[model samples]
Target: MADHAAARTTRSMTVPLVAFVAGAVVAVLLGVLGRVHDPTLSGTTDLGFRTVIEMKVVLATVIGALVVLQLLSALWLYGHLGRRPPSWLGTAHRVSGGLALLLTVFVGYSCLWALGLEVGTLPHGEPVPLRAVVHGVLGCAVFGAVVVKIVAVRARRAPGWFLPVAGGLLFTLLLVVVLTSAAWYVAARGWPGPAGY
Candidate 1:
């Protein structure tokens, strides 16, 4: 009987073990993908201010806004807000989370397809600036962070604090991704006008 009980405990530990392994696999895959050269959008360039990059920036801004909502909704759900959460709060969190994920997929693909993965190197030209490198690194980190968060969600045996820590990490990585890319784009290019680069 004691042996059977010990076996059950061992099985339960597998949930977190699997989650950690999965997250590591995801991070490694992303790292490998970042090194592959995608020539699809190598020659593509828009002279207008409303370029694809500009659009990505706008989309990232929206995602950042949604993250704010995610945080608020999460706090409410967890009773950290010091007030009763509305019945719809949970639904709001789910919808926002889904939307954020979809938008992130779109933006991430757009970046990789349009600009491979380099910091100093141009999409097809010489090195432009250091911000590009920072942006590329942060973008990859975002993927890894997302994988970690998903693992935390699925790991039933994970500590109560793990979810929140994972959530915070995802949020921080996302914010850095936006700041390094979209925000930098806007700073270099005037609104609705093509960049002078």
Candidate 2:
């Protein structure tokens, strides 16, 4: 009977274990893609922005905003906020979370496809900026964080603590991704124009 109980305990962990592995795979794949892919490095405008980089910053800012909503909604749901969250809060969280995920994925792919990693050498170009390099890496990490969070939410046997931890991690990663890219752009370029707002 004890042996059977132990086996059950181990079995219960399988979902989280799989989620962890999936997260690792996501991080590794994005890192590899960022490192190996050839980039366009074009100065073309996107969505009326002055450059592709500018468009990314705009999208990233929106993602950051959405993640803020996610954090607050999660907090309320977890009772970190006042007693009894509204019924609509859960629905709002889902909607915002979905939007945040979609935007994050879009920006990440755009970066990977358009700029690759901000590599040490850029053919005839100068050395890659450290900020750009960090931004690229953080972008890759965001996908990994997202994978873990999604798995925690979807898995039937995930531990009670798993979802909150995953949610917090996703929030932090997304916030940093925004800071490293969009915040830096705003700091240097002094806010994007009509397209950015």
lDDT of each: 0.76, 0.83
For candidate 1, what is the TM-score?
0.79
Q: What is the lDDT of residue 64 in candidate 1?
A: 89
Cα lDDT tens digits for candidate 1, 1-197: 99998887777666556765676676666656766856365554443435777768888888989988998899989999999999988988989998998899788877777776775556588886677777777787777777878877777766566788779988988888888876776787745444664
True lDDT of residue 9, candidate 1: 76
lDDT of 1: 0.76
lDDT of 2 by residue, 82-194 (tens): 88998999999999889888887777877888878766866788888887777777778778888899889987776787888788888888898899889988998877777
TM per prediction: 0.79, 0.89
Backbone clashes, each candidate: 1, 0
Candidate 2: residue 24 Cα off by (Å): 1.3
Q: How does residue 167 of candidate 2 score in lDDT?
A: 86
